[model samples]
Target: MYVRTSEVRGDPARLDEGLRLIREEIYPAVTAMDGCAGMSVLFDRNICRVVATTSWRSEDAMWASTETVRALRESAERALGGTGGSEVHQWEVAVAHHDHPVPDGAHARLTWMSCKPALIDRAVDLFRMVALPQIQEFDGFCGTTLMVDRGAGRIVGTAAVESRGAIESSRDAAAMIRERFSTELDATVDGVEEMEVAFAHLHVPEMV
Candidate 1:
């Protein structure tokens, strides 16, 4: 599976308006496109940051939607009163596992890591064997997805939980495991964040 994420930092006051536009306009449009598997949004009110992610069944489908996506993204930013320029990234869904569909009140903890390009495979293997199991053991754990930019040696891991409390409860343990895994994988932790899963509607593609 392939994923595209567009990140924008904007005013907190306009967040609701942005979300509304996304649901009413962007979501339906993207999902209707060929090979579109799913779409999601992540928001951090405190930081006034929002990220919109779309999953595609194939690379070609993802690339084909670029023009439409560009226009929709511009509309979203305008509605949101977004300030800074957006950052867009493409990734391969290296690992995906779900115990259940993401719930209404789900929250996610995200970690961004950087490592040597040649060690990307090693990082994925370590995550599947060690990190994933540990994460599943946490209370209220719903699912986990690891996205990778192999050429850039970038890995973004998202772990979903039932609520904010669940995210907090698992922090200490999660951090310990993250630290150990980073060491073994020779990865440097760039940033770790927790945010509300503002919207999540992803269909697991057969290919994934």
Candidate 2:
């Protein structure tokens, strides 16, 4: 699967309005498009940051919808009183595991990493074998997905859990695993953020 993520910084007070527009306007429009697989929104209300992700069946489909997606994003940003320009990233869904359907009140921990292109496959293997198992040991673990930009050596790993408490309790362990994995892969840890899964729906089948 191919995914497009738009990171926007906006006014915290206008978050509700922005979410409303995304659900009422953007969701329907994107889902109706050809080859659309899914769409999800992650929000960090405290920082007024929103990460909107749209998944496509193929790279071509994602690229083809660029203009339309850009316009929709701009509209949402305007409605949300976004200050800085958004940062957009394109990625391949490298690994996906569905432990359970994402529940209401789910929260996610997003970790960003940068590595050498040559180590991409090894990184995936390490995540599947080591990182994933360690994370699953935590309470309220829902599922995890790893998205990568191979050419750019960029990776975004998202771990979804039941609540903020689950995330907090698992933080130390998760950080340790993340640090080890990064060191083994010679990756640089960009940053980590906590977010609430405001919305998520997938039209595509599970990858594994």
Candidate 3:
């Protein structure tokens, strides 16, 4: 599977209206497009940042809709009070797993990492074989996804959970595991993001 992400930092004041436009206009239009598998939105109200991700069944499907998606992305960004445009990225999906239904008020934590391109496969193996099983036991955990930009040696791992409180309580433990995991993969932690799962309708098949 392949994914495209559109990220924009905009006016917090216009957030409500922006969300309305996304729910009513942008979402329906995009989902109805050919080969579009699923979509999700991530919002960090504190930073007034929003990211929308669309999954495609194939690379061709993702690239084929790029122009149209770009136009819609700009519209959505403007609705959120953006001026220039949104940042976009394409990624290959390595893992997307969730068996439980996403409950109300789901949250997600994203960890961005980078390793030598040569070690990408080893990093992936360590994540799936070690980190994942341990994460599944976290309180209120829902699912996780690992996306890669192989050429750039970029990895973005997302952990979906039930609520804010769960996040607060687990930060310490999560950080410890994250540190060790990165060390094992010989990767550097680029950054971390915490946000609400604005909406998740991804039909991303489970990939271990």
Stretches of candidate 2 off by over 4 Å are: none
lDDT of 1 by residue, 43-112 (tens): 9988778888999999999999999998999899998888748999999998888887778878999999
- Residue 11 deviation, candidate 1, in Å? 0.8
How displaced is residue 123 in candidate 3, in Å? 1.4
State the TM-score for model 2.
Answer: 0.97
Best by lDDT: 2
Model 3: lDDT of residue 137: 77
> Which run of 10 residues does model 3 get worst, by summed lDDT?
95-104
lDDT (Cα, 0-100) at 176 in candidate 1: 98
What would you estimate as the lDDT of candidate 1?
A: 0.89
How close to the true structure is residue 64 of candidate 3, measured as C-alpha lDDT? 96
* Higher-lDDT candidate of 2 and 3: 2
Clash numbers, per candidate: 0, 0, 0
- Runs of candidate 3 with Cα error greater than 4 angstroms are none
Give the TM-score ranking, best first: 2, 3, 1
Those runs of model 1 whose alpha carbons end farther than 4 Å from true positions after fitting are 205-208
